[model samples]
Target chain A: MHFGPHLLLAALEGLVTSAVLALTALGLSLVFGVMRVVNVAHGEFFMLGAVLAWAITTAIGGHPALGFLAALVIAPLIVGAIALVAERLVLRRLNYNPEATIVATIGMLYIIQQLALTIYGPEARPVEPPFSYRILLPWFGYSGYKLSVIATSALLLIATWLVLTRTKIGLIMRATQYDSETAQAFGIPVGRVYGGVFALGAMLAAIAAALIVPISQAHYLMGQDPLLLSFIVVIIGGLGSLRGTVVAAVLIGLSDGIISMFFSPTLAKIIATLLVAMVLVFRPQGLFGTASR
Target chain B: MTDKNGFFDLSKSTLTRRTALKGLAAGAGLGLAPGFVRYSQAQSSAPIKIGFQSHRTGIGAAYGRWYEKTTAAAVKAINAAGGINGRQVEVIIEDDGTDPGRGAEVVGKFATQHKTDIVFGTLFSHVVIGSAPAAGENKMPYFVVSEGHHVASTKLNRYVFQPGITDVKSQIESMAPWIAANAGKKVTQIFPDFAFGYDHRDYLPPALKAQGADVIAQIAIPPTESSFTKFFPQIPAETEVIYHVMVGPAVLTFVKELGEFYGPNRPQLFGFIDSLEATDINSPGLEFLDGSHFWEGSPRYAQADDSVAQKAYRTAVGIDDNGAAVGDPKDVSTAAHMFGCWETLYVVKKAMEDAGYKGPEDRAKLVEATEALTEFAEGPEHPQGPKTFNGKIHQCFGIQNISKVEGGKLKVVHKTKIEDGLYEAEGDYTTQAL
Candidate 1:
């Protein structure tokens, strides 16, 4: 293989990683930005989506595409509903106190993980890709499913952007994020906004999970790595900044893919950790974060 | 120190009638109910407790689930056979979460809290390595079913023994020549970057060299890596064969990504059964692997020449001919590595009976008796075929299976002799203080 094809392959692979990472991190950013509470269980929501996708697809036996489409719609709604319940019961009771909510979400994480273990069993189950077309590149053939995943994730990210920017719910969320007490004083229901934002954040993660389940089998312990990586992206990209989350996710995911390919995965992780350390030492507010008064 | 009262001390052991009943029920479910009533009648004698360190929560959860099943099945069989030395054997399980620090803590809990006579049943190599020191400190006989060469290499304590499973060094030594001759001479290895994968990385190069083969490129992937397309371009163009041995929950992804990377036009593929341990071959995306080969510790699919003992064991474990659950086709059995757990429990029974093991006081005697074990023939006790145990290294030498993918099933193509995998004893566990 020549240098050009090899680089193109790596770039394409990196882009796919970036796509998934972007969506996942965007959810984390949205939750933190709107609710002012870190969702430690965000990855569990992601895992729940994938596992539900597997369950849904397996139960409704027929064309793979039909199963996937059903899962694509149903899994996120279910996950979002669960998140809404969690927000009302746990986060709302805690008054969304940053430290308390972190601990609460950690508890939620183990509960969700154990529940998954009980219902899904420990076995990793794969979902059949809806299609099996291979797009022929100049150097090699690529998985059309993977390319579709990249495209789908991008469209989802745009929709998320539109929701946060163009909709009335988006305005209410921004107002509550700006000042919850004042928003409540202005007749905006802050609690409802918080609940909606939490559900939307979880829904975004679920959608990403639904997209990637065909490629990555769903397992109980699959949530931890994505959680860690998303935290890294949120930290580097500036927590609560959706635009910064996207930029940072693309940077981290692409570098991880390219570096892991050329050298070793260990090296890629080391570089990522080093980058995180540098960001912490020099730019505590993160690249796109504004310093609070 | 026992209180001189007529009543026995309950603090020393948690073997209440409730636990005994639970064990009996578990045994019955696991196909070992023949002597449960008899054992319960003689339950006045304290049951021998074995601490089972299970990987119930992490990346090893899939294997851990099967290992627990096999352990239960073996324990049921042991109890049904009138128990070890006529005492009902109870397994006290503790989940290590497949984390190293937690593994040691679980071992400590087994020694101090559970008061188990011996600690056993850890599958992942790193967990074994982490927990072995706790076992050594407690002077508990640790019998692991893990395939890492650490025990045999003298890196672990004398208390740690792998008397039922062949280590990676021996396995690779046995399979290298066959892979070279049948697969290709120019190999490229893709293995997880950990102690288990390092075993393959370290042993296969020299073993392949001995077979007049050479590895052109070696790729070390993180065990947690879910996506693998990025690493495929690194394989040298002239690579004749791709040897992959990946673990964790992402094995299907690893394989699917590999198929995506290579498509129809690919090099010869020879992978360890680790890559597909719990995966169904007939699953959709795996059609690309229809003609590939895999090295299995035990063939996943039951072969035509399977012994009656193998079939009986499968029935007891509820695994069907296709290596899936009897009724649930989607649930796959990790047939390759899980057999070691079943065989190891039997080995424990044999050694315990040989030493007339009565309690924790007799644990040292049991270890020595286990080291004295020589060859195990194919029977209900050893369904994974014949094995010769090396007392010095505390690892067993067993026949290795080379199975080909035919008609969406793994068919045994070659079986290496026991001697083919044996190497010079690295260190004598006997030389170390018991």
Candidate 2:
């Protein structure tokens, strides 16, 4: 009703968007960080996750929670496994050449998109939220599911941070990221590390899709925007910096939400693009990014 | 003998030159005598090839999938009923990818590569707009089933016509009064930012104003936008009605987000079927819209008082009473907009017969014949309802349905008359140089 209340609501909406964007962008950053190969089909993996979630939920049948839980556990694993296979068969065949992988992943994008079209059909299908309850705000009531999405996404982000900081696999991944040839010299199985990181990156994207699918319908064409937005986030964050990606996601996501709420979506996009230009001009390596040698 | 659809059936045993003559006599009774006579000539009885310019692989893919099915079913029925002119009706389909440039290219392919007699079956407004000039240049009769006002607005040449479907202007004009009175007077409009959405943005205000209502806030959203919560906060708090007509792949998200943003303290909701075009109403998040109203070109679910023709058409199209494919419940029909494909095919048939269209040489004659058509009856050809075709404007005036969500199905609560949508012709396609 009042300006203050509306601003608060806008911020709340921004947080939800930021939460999803962080998970999705972190995946892209992680893949670029360790592998030095940009995955053009990352968005397709996200889309596949949502589609598989729909299929599994439809197949499982019964209480939505059961189907949703099963989808949450299975869809990302399936998507990550598919990404692993792609890395092994396609990226490995190309020797993970940067320019070649771009073209290869674009091909992968179309292949996965068409396959989803054939299997999922062309309809945007709704997956029932596992539960629905209202949380009353000062001005209006909000969906309980959205709050859960924000919470779950934050938890997933924290878990990712913990894994990267505290685990053996994370240490191997960090070593690989530091220098693949050096890591190989140290008996790290660099190729296997690349494959695992690729899979992990895809899994993070799939997890984000699985979480958001209930709010947004699963569609084959749904990948394009998220792909574009994720690219923007990664670029503005400095290509391979995970911390920068998270911070950039929050900034872009919240600004996009709040600006779109107050002014126009077109204006919001214009401002975001301008901000990207400004960031690239002043801080070419990004805020948290280390300058390359 | 007759079939379930009241079509005259010929016994397989009676197959000869005399049988063709007998079929001519039967055709006379069925008002297909000209077609039969043409068939009897026997010099050229090849199937009348209609090129279907489809959006098989883009944002419009969902609508395209259903439109393809409906077109196939219509062609199947027409072929079964002794073909269009005793020659089988063949449909040659090419995927346009729903891109405007590709749309025009597809039209060019139909004109040159396929050598289709006529090109038809494009749905998205931008695609139709992009492709129409190509049809004109190629002298191909372009019969569009798109609901965009572009055809009727006469931005397109004489080659384009939207005779089977009502455009957004007509639809909004017809329903504005009902929306104003029953839903609310002061409205907050949320529409996709595009030509199609712009039609609603442009037309609805004046139409609503005519009914003593005003649009308070007009929020234009990017068509491809998936998340919509940010846009919801922009709607004025004092707004009594939220009028939404969103398109693209994120319609479910748009509606679900609106529901979430407002919850129990929301304003009245009125939406075009575009908001939930291919979505199930009983979807968990959409329960908030239990009593909201939607404007449908045709009711998604079959009503109790559905006409016999509607029933026959539904059976032919494989859409069950619930508006899903009979074989798969989850495969929901794009029931609102797809009827145009079925109806447009019939209009094409009628025009072809009226013109005694023989081949590509008589394309001009067929166009003129289509322009001469005034009315279509509520029958198998137009299961949506009877419509009045304003051939001058190249648009149709049809019954518009305002349905409420009841028990997870749209039940028609209001139906507007053809006259409610009538307006002065924007520019006459008939007057345009052919």
Query: Candidate 1: what is its chain A TM-score?
Result: 0.97
Q: Please, what are the lDDT tens digits per residue for candidate 2 over residues A1-293? A: 67887788788888887888888888998999899988989999999989999989989989998999999999999999999999998898777888888988999999999999998888888887788777877777677888899999989988988888899988899888888898999999989988998999898889889988998889998788778789889888987787888888889888987888888778878988888788789988877777775
State the fnat of candidate 2 relative to the true structure: 0.74
Going through the candidates in the order shown, the clash numbers are 0, 0
Alpha-carbon error at A180 in model 2, in Å? 1.1
> What is the docking quality class of candidate 1?
acceptable
Model 1 scores a C-alpha lDDT of: 0.89
RMSD in Å for model 1? 8.1
Residue pairs in collision within model 1: none
Tens digit of per-residue lDDT, candidate 1, span B1-434: 24453234668876889999999999777775555544464434778899999988888888888998888988998899898888888999999989989999999999998889888889889899999999999989999989999998988888999988899999999999999999999999999988999999999999999999999999998787888888888889899999999998888888887788788888999999999888898877888898999999988898999999999999998899999988998889899999998899889988988998877878899889999999888899999999999887889989999999999999999999998998988777798887
Candidate 2 runs further than 4 Å off: B1-43
Predicted candidate 2 versus true structure: per-residue lDDT over B1-434, tens digit per residue: 65553334787345789988998889778875555665465536778999999889899998888999999999999998987766789999999999999999999999998889999999998899899889999999999988989999888899898988899999999999999889999999988888899999999999999999999999998877888877776788889999998888888888777777787778999999988876778777787888899999988899989999999989998988889889888788789999999999999999998998889999999999999999999998999999999888888889999999988889999999999998888777787777
Q: What TM-score would chain A of each candidate receive against the reference chain A?
A: 0.97, 0.97
| lDDT against the true structure, each candidate | 0.89, 0.88
